[model samples]
Target: MMITSYADSALSLLPPVVAIVLAVVTRKVLLSLGLGIIAGVILLTDFSFTGAASHLVSTVTSLVWDDGALNAWNLQIIGFLVVLGVITALITVSGSARAFADWAHQRIRNKRDAKLMTMFLGCVVFIDDYFNSIVVGSIARPITDRYHISRAKLAYLLDSTAAPVCVISPVSSWGAYIIALIGGILTAHGFADTGHLSVFLQMVPMNFYAIFALLLLLCVAIFGLDIGPMRQHERNAQKGELFDESKGLPPGATADLPEADTGKIMGLFLPIFVLVAATIYFMVSTGADALAGEGLPFSVLGAFENTEVSESLFYGSLVGLVVTIALTMQQKISTSMMFTGIKVGAKSMLPAIYILLFAWTIASVIGELETGKYMASLATGNIPFALLPAVLFLLAGLTAFSTGTSWGTFGIMLPIAADMAMGSDSTMMLPMLAAVLSGAVFGDHCSPISDTTILSSTGASCHHLDHVMTQLPYAIIVAVISIVGYTVLGFSGSVAMGFITCSVLFVLAILGLKIATK
Candidate 1:
């Protein structure tokens, strides 16, 4: 008899439990992760007793030594980081980010509209959070300030929308990752008939968190309902005390710097266009064989056959960095200033990168341990057959939230969730998979230590704590609605009907939010 909810399932969850406790106690992410990793090592030690240290040593060693170390996906993520560094360096040197502020200065009149526009900018980028934070923040900052919109709110809007919107959209790289992961899982579990992308698309409706959170953000933007810390930050910004979120900076301090970077703005925008064009072109050329080990060939479609979105951005950024630097020199920025930009960009980003690495490593550890089986067993044991879709939704959310990576969450839970859908005659799989994606995004949105959350704050140049504080209220509102939506979905009797109900409820909730906020 196969058992679910085995003791080992709890073992897999131990790391996150430790991380949260340590984060609470120390308030330092590095220390918290270090402690959590050490706890994992400790647990492995006890699991082996005499071979504990050896097992830990072997695991860490395998991370670097294993062929999986250079797996396409892992390399792609690392490559993306390199590109980010290069692009950020160029933006700072060219002062394009500053020029964007100057441009925004012309359009912004007051805080209310400033907040609204920030939300609009976040929605427009909808494909990737990485693009959302930096592109939107740098471009919109001036307008936000002109309207006396606090940096905190700017960060809130930017951070809030980035991950949530990406997870929900079908055309995004995010969409590809989750869909592909879930598809692979389903294939492993004997449901290999449906294409991964199609399965992923079907599930979008059930992803309550992503849908609901966006709903709340829209509502708040229109009506200006300040909830919790978000409201406090809004009030602070209105009084020109926005910069007060940081202990080190005085209010309106950037007012002193010769603040405009037209070149940086152009440089940033052009590269992004190039990157997107390259990504779309590659996706088209690759067809169905993407990430399936097709080697590079020079044919029009062949060039992109083996290429990934991460690779495209990585290469584009290398070109962009050189161009931005050359243009910066022509703009007569001193060599020292160029170097300073690199220093600042790198220094500012270290904490985020650290969090990314730790989060990635922890997720990797779970995969290595084959812990997903334990998790699946737990789900199968506790959830009723009829309510499987809703249960899958919760499982996906919990996994991603605990792991702090949406892709990883989908990868781990998809196989398990798909297997659970075996007895269902109704079309519940899509909703189940969507729940996985939406739930993962929800956790990533609020978690202070999540990579997207960290990046959004950094891009907005808002204090990290302030971004988390202000955005949490909006996140919670959507979560409440999403939870109700999912529970109703279990008994709604049909997928289409459930989706319609959810959509209507979401719309009404957003409208209600707008009315109350006003």
Candidate 2:
């Protein structure tokens, strides 16, 4: 049955609002998302119970098998997650994690150093947010654990860095996607002479939220600036509690993995190096193949624009898994123990996989409801030109927060923002576009159903809600600062002034938090 869109109606907002409220209240992500999906289907089916049931089944089936074939992108991401889990398990069982921890302990003497290292690693792995989210956590977790850093804090560092870094980096998957969109938007607006890359580069400086968020992360790491629930988590960690025991281990984490005494640091470091190297190689290779298929010449930027990120991640992770297995064998781990690691690792990812599946399904339902479209529509008409950047930022943030997909929010809001800018003052285009990018990342950081948010918690072995609750205050602080920055830019027409204002405000905010907390 074909479902009609509720995009023109206020009811379009109901599903996501329900989902967000329930997720917060119940602290059951899957249940919240399931009900949200059902709620959307009911609205689409005019409250027919049987119709809602059938629609739900069809919607889920379509996620796995779309357009008469398997949904390769979704499946590949799932494959990568499982493979990464196995790699993590293998390293733990082989004692590579312990060895790496011992090595790190020698160098990283305090929580501050451990956090700064995690932030540094996160910035270094800016190729893709998903890869960064998990890989950085896998490598840095041992060090942070050794320093008694709370899992929530580690997850915050990972989550805050992942999207903020990706959204701003020119060579990253997020950048490629956004540049492609901007190219089309520019041409459509009769700015065919303007280079898309140039516009993207200029906009990078104007992306207040992303820059401020990263700076705030640095301040938190350097100054031990913990506020809100995060401070409690940090206090608990100092008392030898890294997480709430009642919440259980995070998905894709196992507490009982046997650590071998003979584990070497190379066992961990080698596999991770291979993972990053192989993934970058595959990303470029696949991108080049795509360029060739399109009868276009190869360039690094072009390859990135054409690359299949999920496919590259899957292949790279598979290679990493093979290397990990070989290293485990060399360490003389028992065959039975290795097999147990495989089983445990694969099984551990199920909860996360389930949550992701539900999140995707609800996202799809919300799409059908035209939730983002409705939200984006609100930003249209009769707006003062100076306030355009700040308005777009808020709208994009709301759309992404409701949908739980920054990319989806980008798709929905970028064209609308472009049209608005073209219709008004073309001079405000780059700043407006930058605001959309910044807001999407900010919103994704706060969203419980966001994939990066989920993976960050999994990577740090923290309860998903614990990560969400702890990170909310920090995200809000950055977002508020971003809004003020954009407002200043809009009124002053100076990107530098706006950024300087944001920076000053951010420093003051950090200092204020430190003093208040003290």
Candidate 3:
């Protein structure tokens, strides 16, 4: 199961490339992933057909169940998915979602308000991207649908805020991962005295993509700015066509909410409240062990620094599900009905679960191939210090796009970025680090193969490809601005001036996009 490195260069890239191409051409995520796995195994087995077939079987076995081993990361994620599915289904069956939608419909008069509110919800649930995407999508979809907003736009909002917000939030799951990576890197490079948390906070100002993305999304929602394919989708939505009917609504998406006088708004808000509270509490409790040696103060920040997010999400969601079921019982729902609803919800999530499993398997294949390591090695040659940030930005973006993961890219590139800065220019360290973080997010935002991307589509009930197409232009625009900002900051060595400049430029770009799209 341990694959350290690859002897063949061309073979390393073939797996992901094949996966990407197949997914795009066929629009079949599962098939594409399977083919990609087979191709990777074939290359790994020195092009022997029999060897490749056997390796593929073994890899799938380990990836799924792992030889009677109950403990597996893939299984953990799958369990989380099933629990989330049950929770969502229980909410829907209890008519809480319908009640909440009706309440939101009355308050939100226009598409602009609906979108802004959705964005607000996305911001509020910043603890984890997966949670944000699903919870926000579930709550906001009914409102957005009522206003004739395209599912593509909903997915974009969900996807953008999920990873982007989590990456920037100091206490989020994304923050924990980045801190661990940077901490290790800094320690190895003789910067052990500097706190990783401190370094991350310092880079916050220079995190142009995350900052700009937040502003841009808000502006776009408020200003009604629609451009590129998103514009067409918006136009169609205005005409009461949320999506092409031929494609049909995604699973878990309700085309119509039942008309009932019994549904209460509390049915919706109460479960969400419990879910959020439980998630935060679980994080603190699980992370309590991380603060064992620390004296007094009992820092909330410190607890977040060491929290096991996946475990927290799993347990927190289970608590939330149990609460939802209790509320359903209070509503006089039959036990059999609740069980049926759970089954329906889990079944609806089958597509998403399958895609997630395949994506993880492909990621494993690519990791074994050392594709990212090969790509990261390219940053070593002679390059101008001023352009180092820009180079790192582009490299990280490409690596994340190819790997379909930003966290994985961070693990691969942060050390290289840190080492490169340590060897040559120290001033370039923060900027280069920021570049890697931003670029990885940028790529993840746009990648069809990304887990967040799939989650967003599932949450919003939009077609997966539709979400990618609509969001790509926005991600690209922000990336271009981020590249420009990093390039200028690298040369000027002024984070404040560069940030202010980028902030203004981003707003202006939003304004221009508004006008041009109009």
Which segments of candidate 1 are over 4 A away from where they belong?
1-7, 47-86, 89-95, 181-200, 239-268, 271-307, 368-373, 463-466, 500-518
Tens-digit lDDT track for model 2 on 1-518? 35575654689788888888999999988888888888999998888899889989899998889989999999999999899989999999999999999998888888899999999999999999999989999999989988889999999999999999999898999999999999999998898899888889988889998888898999899989889899999999988888988877788686798889999999999999999999999999999999999899999999999899999999999999999999999988999889888988888888888988988988888888888888898898788888888989998999899889999999999999888878877888888889999999988998887888998988887888899999999999999999999999999988898899898898889879889778
lDDT winner among the candidates?
2
Mark the regions of model 3 whose C-alpha exceeds 4 Å error after superposition: 1-10, 254-260, 290-298, 334-337
Residue 441's lDDT within candidate 2 is 92
Consecutive 10-residue window with the lowest summed lDDT within model 2: 1-10
lDDT of every predicted structure (CA atoms): 0.62, 0.90, 0.81
Q: Which stretches of candidate 2 lie over 4 Å from their true place?
A: none
Q: Is candidate 2 or candidate 3 better by TM-score?
A: 2
Predicted structure 2, TM vs. truth: 0.98
Which pairs of residues have clashing backbones in candidate 2? none
What TM-score against the true fold does each predicted structure earn? 0.81, 0.98, 0.94
**Local lDDT at 194 for model 1:** 67
Best by TM-score: 2
Better of 1 and 3 by lDDT: 3
- lDDT per residue for candidate 3 within 176-214, as digits (tens), equals 778878888888878899988889999887888888888
Task: Measure candidate 3: CA RMSD.
Answer: 2.4
- Positional deviation of residue 180's Cα in model 2 after best superposition, in angstroms: 0.5
Ranking by TM-score: 2, 3, 1
